[model samples]
Target: MTLKSALLAVLFASTAAVAVAQTPLPPADPLDDRSAKRVERMEKVVRELRSIVFQGRDTGKPVVVQPAETDAQIMSLNQRLSDLEQTLTRLNGQNETANFELTKANRAAADQKARADALEQRLVALENAFNDLKTQAAAAPAAGAYPPPPAPPADPAAAFKQAKDLLLGGDYGNAEQAFSTYVTNYPDNARTPEARYWLGETLFVREAYTDAAGAYIGAIRGWPQTTWAPDATLKLARSMVALKKTADACRTLDELTKRYPKAPANVTSRAASTRTAAKCG
Candidate 1:
């Protein structure tokens, strides 16, 4: 090529190189420091080319610009830029993989927590159900253990008569049960107090002195003017003496004398014997 054409071509190429080097790089570029150093080297080369052109022009001499050197520099700069781009691509891929793994782990943890909570709720429900079943079992009566007593007759007098017949027949077990039913079913009946006294007799015969005392007390609660009152009182004192309650037996005997001044000789004699047994004054 001609000397002037060669000079013009070299100048144009150098100017283009400066323009490319001066272009603003994207802010997010990972190889910013290396790219800036490359730009600085390109600016120094441009300065050297301008100096060579001006010196050649001033001296009126032909400048030999080697095309191979320029081509080699451009090729080296392109190779460096390609390496930087590849590095940035690899880093972005690794970042995306790490983010994906972290998100998956978080989701797995959340799922595990949810399962644990559900299991805990199920366990709590089972425990509550077990407690409820235990409570129901405790409250319910045993099955077929003891049959219920027969129902009392509808009429109060008939019920009382039935209990009295059971007592007169010497069926003390059935008489006690029947008299208890009569007393409970017919509390307002005139015969209820007498039934209570008869229930005490059945219990006394069975040597259930504690229960007999309670039945006798219930029969004479208001000191009924019935024929059985004195007898029931004397039996109450005898029951107290059997229970080793000497003071109570004495008090009961005194109450019987005061309450029933006209008590039968047999009942009074029995009270006196009970007081003697208790060693009462």
Candidate 2:
């Protein structure tokens, strides 16, 4: 070979080697379009550089060529791609964590609602049970399950005296109960009217004016001629005054003076006071 031919061949070989060395590698991700396009452009630039070098050699002229991207710039782009991939992975993890927390919060809210519903149901059940107990308690007496009535006295006169003694001893509560039982058991007894009058005295002492008035009327029925009748008539008028029945009280006072003309001095004096209180004419 001639010396000039050998120099051209060496120059062509060196230029082709530089072009091969400067060619960039294919991108790691085949689906990355920008990287793939960059690699394709680099390859095309290398091919064009090789074509220019071969043409220069044929025409006896030197050709200069430069690479599209430096080594540092390529490395920087690869690092940026790796950072972008890592950021995507971190974002995906954060999204998963957020979704998990949201689901857990929803479950907790459902649990709280279920607990509240259970508590409300329990309260309703407890209220219903209390109402049932109240109903049963109210119905006990009607169903005949309550305590029985007390036994009747063996001797009606003896019972009447004992009840009178109780009243004299200041035990008005027991005296009232005893008189009430005596009147109920021996309704047709000779002393029943007097028992009723004493019952009215017991009720009057306790300020049960309406009940005392009723008992006094029961005692004075038919205007019995007993020793207690004059006092009973006076007490009936006083009970009527306490009951706010001024007209009834005046009529009762008039009946007392007409029926018992010689009532005891104390009873007549009390009757006069009661008539004044009642504004009797």
Candidate 3:
């Protein structure tokens, strides 16, 4: 054989062997089930490769002769193709590993974001709770501060009724107690001045002139704008007269008439005034 022809034969044999070896082996069938979809897909790919090779052979562009050395050449090419296929498989494995890492990383990132959102929600809740606590504290009264008790309610009607009942019953001690109770219990009651006036009258009837005069003065001070004032003023002068303090009684009676000329107790007041003027003169 010619050297160039032999070389071409070796080249063609090597190329065919390389093509054959470059084809991947079918993946192992799971449980020997060669009828699975993956096995079918591998068969389809093998058929496509054989079809492409048959078409290339049929094209017949150049004449090349087979050489006696073609077997070794074919085997060497197949080994190279197998090496290339192994390299491609390794690259595919690396790609799949990279995709798996990417998926894991994405999931981790989502978890981290979820944790961050949860922490943020907790922080907001804590802030709101703190603000609510601050508001409650601001609304609270100062320490050591207490509200004062309200003033005791007055019973003016009850006080008057009890005083009148006492005076009518003629129990002097109980009557005085009732009037004093009225004064103590209903200091601002409208009947307080009247109670004092009655108290003075009760004392006067008991011949306690000084105490009666004091109570009458109290009545005048407590009920100055009322009709009881002039009556109490006149009674005060009477009380002084009973105590035999003529000059003092005269002065009191004179002042009573001068201060309250149109008093409802005008007759009694004027009469006392006249007696006081005569005695003093």
**Winner by lDDT between candidate 3 and candidate 1:** 1
TM-scores for candidates 1 onward, in order: 0.46, 0.46, 0.40
Candidate 2 on 125-211: residue-level lDDT in tens?
999999998899887846533233344468998889888878898878788888999999899998898899999999999899989
Give the Cα error of residue 165 in candidate 1, in Å: 0.7
Q: What lDDT tens digits, residue by residue, belong to model 3 across residues 246-270? A: 7888887777768877877565646
Where model 3 places Cα greater than 4 Å from the true spot, the runs are 1-154, 264-266, 273-278
Which candidate comes out best when scored by lDDT?
Answer: 1
Alpha-carbon runs more than 4 Å astray in model 2: 1-152
Please rank every candidate by TM-score, starting with the best.
1, 2, 3
Q: Of models 1 and 3, which has the larger TM-score?
A: 1
